[model samples]
Target: MFILGISALYHDSAAALIKDGEIIAAAQEERFTRKKHDLSVPINAIAYCLKEAGIDVGQLDAVAFYDNPILTMERFLDNLVFAAKTDDTDDLMKFSYDSIFGTKLWIHKELEQALGGLGKLGKLLVAEHHISHAASAFYPSPFEDAAVITMDGVGEWATTTIGYGNKEDLKILRQINYPHSIGLLYSAFTYFCGFKVNSGDYKLMGLAPYGKPVYYDLIKERLINIKPDGSYRLNLEYFDYQYGRAMTNEKFAELFGGERRYPESAITKREMDMAASAQKVVEEVLILTAKTAKEITRSKNLVMAGGVALNCVANGKLLKEKIFDNIWIQPAAGDAGGALGCAFYAYYQYYGKKRVIGISDSQKGSYLGPAFSDEEIVKFLSQNEYPYEKFESAEMFYQKISALLQDEKVIGLCQGRMEYGPRALGNRSILGNPRSESMQSQINLKIKYRESFRPFAPSVLKETVLDYFELDGESPYMLFCANVQEHLRKEFSLDSLLDASNMDMLPVVNQARSEIPAVTHVDYSARIQTVDEERNPEYYRILRQLQKDTGYAVIINTSFNVRGEPIVCTPEDAYRCFMRTGMDVLVLNHMILYKEQQPEFVEWEDWRKSYELD
Candidate 1:
């Protein structure tokens, strides 16, 4: 059976193709379109998936969308009606009306147009938003039967949902509906701290370790009423997302001192404190929720999907609490993974197909995106008259890259299929020596062209994962953070190195916290991606060779592109990003190109203007 599943008309639009319940190909529309979080129908992504599957549009047995349009329209109507009663939202009503009547009502039409006349022949399946999220979490997981939880800003009427998946039967046991969302509560802090809502939440997470949670008590007293069992309700009077254009209202700003911080402004103590407080609240809520999931479902395993599942800090805390014996998180846990979930929902649940569990997972390491051949890469290099070197064997190639990395030379690596999730994994990643004290600042300022305080993650060999970090098992998708091993950490006071009066974080970010300082955050925690041979053979070999040459197996890994740019999806995209940044080497498949050997590069327009900053 062939199924094409889609998540579109919202952020992170994507398409996934599956054959006989096995994922064949999947890619986000942003990769092809060069737009960050493209919300249109994933036409380009769908075309790529079909071509990769060696099928035409006619071969699709059923096309599934991630959510129901009618249900979504109902939610919008409910919110709009409530807004009219309390706020001056006449203009919002007109915009919301056009947005729903104009686009949400035409999802089927958009799919037909996107598929190029498939409406006449193909069966269209629509799953509830949380059902799509739950299926994505449970079906691809290694667990046979597990408790499932999905939490996000809003999905139709559901904001948070708890479910149980046994064999092919997936049931929604309970739910908390709209306006009382934990995701939105955190997002409100993201907005107030001078960051974009969905795009800037990670920045807030990164900033939390710098400040004390001074407002934890205040937030508990006013903003929310979180119970011992993890259920909570928001103090809606302080938020504006239901009716106003902003995430928070005047009442919210008054609680936090005053005014939302303007974008690109100087960092302050208030933003840091708010970030810390919000993070503490999120962790407490997740731990309590996991306890509830354990008691209700009485399942030893837990699987999670949804935007809130992307909180690695909270994930690590929950893991430490040992709320479940086994835990699995969807790498693309946001809306993009909804495509995978809806497809699984249709195949196993709708078609009544027998379920088969995977040894690790059925996601194929989430490396189901398009990959280019050496021949195609050669053609691009030859056409552009660029210079390069080729390695004949894997042995010499791995050794050569390891040596470059040891000397603190940054490498842009694009190998195999691109990752389907937001994370780079190893295929689309920037490589650097984590032992170098200045490497993090160099990569942040010169390569990524982003903030200085943001920390890098480590791609450590799976065999030596426990040697470097306090992890019980592997973290293949870079979804969790734990403290770097105590012995590897330095006895340094982070505050002693700081200028107490000035709020500049660069001085503090540069302070060495561990033996592998570049990947270590201010709090000594590292977001880790453990490289294993089974899932990522080539990346595994590279890290193994590095360990043989150096005492440590850990190396810095960040996404292959600069800030605001999507991770590179093509050889051309990789090369352009290489030329535009401070990276020293470009590795595409088996070919290696040095920066000094390439032709002089120029862009017609300022490359900085190419992408809108997240």
Candidate 2:
């Protein structure tokens, strides 16, 4: 049976197709639309999946939406009624109610429209929001039985869910309901720290290590009442998300000792402290929650999927704690993964089909997106009259790329199948020499055109992971951070440490903190992706070649896109981004193009303005 799964009308909207429980294709709408966090119905994404499966809409046996819209609307109505009873019916609240009521109440119709009409589409199956998340986490995981947890901003009436998945059956054991969400609490801090809420929570995570968590006690005391078993409730007096569009109220500002930090304004110690405190709180709750799940389910393995699962720092801490024998996190742990989850849930639970477990995961390394043939790439290059050279063999190509990395050239690589998750992995990545002390700043300023504080990830050969990082297991999804090995770290002088403060950490951050300085964060931690040859042979070969030449098995890897843009999806998208950014080389399949040899790109008038700053 062909099942089409979708997550739309929310951020990171996406579509996925599964045939007999195996994922055929999956992609986020942002990739095709060139809109970061595109929330519109994933029409383009749905078309891609259908085309990839070589089937028409009529061929689909079922269409499973990630969440039930009716239940979601009920939550909205409940909140609206509560607001009315409290005599808090203002224009903003009314607008909120009307907007949600008009736009969200008719999601079934929207689904039909998205599928090119209900007549052409098949049966419509609706899965609960958190159930979809849990299914996505456990169904595709290698574990046959595991404890499951899903936490995110309000979904229907649930904010957090604790569950267990055993083979074909998954059950929700306990839940923390709406209005008291860890996700919303983090988002509120994200907003207070001057970042976009949903999208910038990770930025808050990235900023955490820069400051002390001095406000941890204050946050727990005044904002949230977290329990020993991880069940928590927000004080509600300080938060505004329950009734207002803004995440925090004036009382929240008073508690934090100031107003919300203006976006793009100067970064202060206060923002850093808040970020640190929020991150600490999140980590504490997650650790406690994991323990509770383990105690409840008595499962040695754990699976996690949710927007909060994207916090690699917390994941790393949890992994280090050894709460479970093993943990597997969905690569696309956010809403995008919900599409995959809902499809799997429909296939196994709704249809009562037995699941065929895999040794690793059924995600196929999260490389279930599009892959262009050499002929297609050649055709595009030839048609565009682009300058390029074809490699004689894969070995030769790897050798040449390795030499470029040794020479400190930033190369945009588009090879094999595109990744299904938010991460670029190797198929779609901008790679650099991790050993270069200046590589981080160069890529951030010249290539990515983003904040300098953001740290790049490293794609290390799986066999050599322990050589550089203090990690015990595979981190194939780049969803965990670990400190650089002591031998690899460059000891900082006492003067440099004393001079570094929240306001001016650039001096310290610019210093070589480790052998692989480009990927190493200021805290001496690195978000690592262990590249196994079976999953991505080409990328593994490249890293191996770099290791042979430079005695380093790691290379800097960042998503293959500039600021405010989704990762490049097509050869055309890769070529445009290559020409637009300061990257020195573009690798399209077996062909390579040198930036200096390419035809002059007529700069658009203020092209930077085209993309909205995130």
Candidate 3:
């Protein structure tokens, strides 16, 4: 049986398709549309999945949506009544009920209309928001039984939920409702810090390292009330986010002793301190929640998804605590992963199929989207009359690219599989030599066009991760953190280290960490992707060749597109990005296109520029 899953109308819209309990295709709508976190119906994504699966929409046995609308509406009305009871009229935008319902309740009929109504499919299943989030977390986990935690801003009414998933069953134990969300708290700070709400939270996480957590006590004492069982309630008086909204209010500004930071303005000690404070609070709440989930379910293994699961720092702490023996996080842990969750939910929940014991069947393998054939790439290039050359073999391709990389040239590598998560990994990545301190600044300003302190990630060979990092297992999803090795620190250190005693205070410094420093964070920890030849053989072979030539088994790996645009999904998109950016080389399938060889411009009248130019 074939099953389709969808998450939309909220941020991070996406789609997933499953056949006989195995994930066949999955992708976020943003990747195809070039709209970052597009919150409309994922028509392009659904069409791509159908195309990938070699079927039409009519062939699907069942379709599942990630959230139930009625339940979500009920929560909206309740929150509105609660807001009025407090007489919160001054903070009209965020605390009003109409604003909240308008964003959530209005999407259902709109979605069905987008889906071509009931005539297109025989049955449509509407899964509860948190249930779908919980199912997405546990069902694909490689554990016979695992405690599941789903945390996001607000899903219908539930902001946080705890449950357990075993072979064929899932049981939700308890929930923390809306107006008391860890996500909203973090997002409030995200907005106050002058960043976009849903999209800017990661920026808040990145800004934490630059400041100290001075507001921790104040936040805990005034904003939220945490209980013993990991349940918490927000103090409605100090904030507003109920209706039409921006997160914080005048009271919040006063509490913080100032107004929100202006975007792209000076990055003061204040913003940094706020980031650190919010991050610390988020970490504490997550740990407390994880510990509570373990106690309630008594499950040794844990699986987590939802937007909160994207907080790698918090996830690292959870892993370090040893409360759970193992943890598996969905790479696309936000609403995008809900598509996969919905598809899997249809398989195990609706069809009553038995899950394979201890199997994570979402062949997602990090690379789950469309990959262009050499012929298709060649056709596009030739039709556009773009200058390019073809290599005889994979060895030749790697040998040439490796030489370009050693000279500190930025190379856009678009090869075999497309990644499913926010990270690009190697398949859809821009590569650079990481040893140069200037590389970070150059890529940030010249290419990424984003923040300076926001660090890059490294793609290390699976066998060589230990030589540079203190990690023991495969970090295929780039979720976990491992410190750098101690031995190699001396080689890269610019300052003098005369005494061994100095090392005591600098535990994370000068570790033989993955030979790539730009990608490594301030703590000498890296979110790593271990490349094994068996999984992505072609990409691994390229890395192996580069390693042989450079004596380093690592390369700076980041998403293929620039800051605001989504990762490139088509040859046209890839070529346009390559032309616009400062990249030195474009490796499209077997064809290699040098920047110098291409024409100054097509300047053709027929060129419509319909493809996303960014």
Pick the TM-score winner: 1
Which ten residues in a row are the worst by lDDT in model 2? 493-502
237: Cα error in model 1, Å: 0.5
What digit string (tens of lDDT, one per residue) describes model 2 on residues 1-614? Answer: 98988998777999999999998999999999999999888999999999999998888888888988788777777777766777775744566665467766677778787676532345578899999999989998999999999999978888999999999999999999998899999999999989998988988988888777999999999999999999999998887777756899899999888899999787777887889899999999999999999999999999999999999999999999999999999999999999999999988988899988989888889998889999999999999899899998888988999999999999999998889888999999999998889999899889999877789999999999999999999999999999999998887652455355536655555788888898888788999999998888889999999989888999999999998889999999998899898999999988999999999888758768878888
Pairs of residues clashing in candidate 1: none
Query: What are the Cα lDDT values of the candidates?
Result: 0.91, 0.89, 0.78
Candidate 3 has a TM-score of 0.90
Ranking by TM-score: 1, 2, 3
User: Which numbered prediction scores highest in lDDT against the true structure?
Assistant: 1
* Model 1: ten consecutive residues of lowest lDDT: 114-123
Listed in order, each prediction's TM-score against the native is 0.98, 0.97, 0.90
Question: How well is each residue in 286-331 modelled by candidate 3, as lDDT tens digits?
Answer: 8999999999889999999889888877887778788898888888
Q: Write the per-residue lDDT of candidate 1 for residues 19-133, one digit (tens) a residue.
A: 8988999999999999988888999999999999989888888889999889888988788788878766775675667767898778888788768756324657999999999
Q: How much is the lDDT of residue 580 in candidate 2? A: 90
What shift in Å separates residue 193 of candidate 1 from its native position after superposition? 0.3
Q: How does model 2 score by TM-score?
A: 0.97
Candidate that beats the other on TM-score, 2 or 3, i.e. the better one = 2
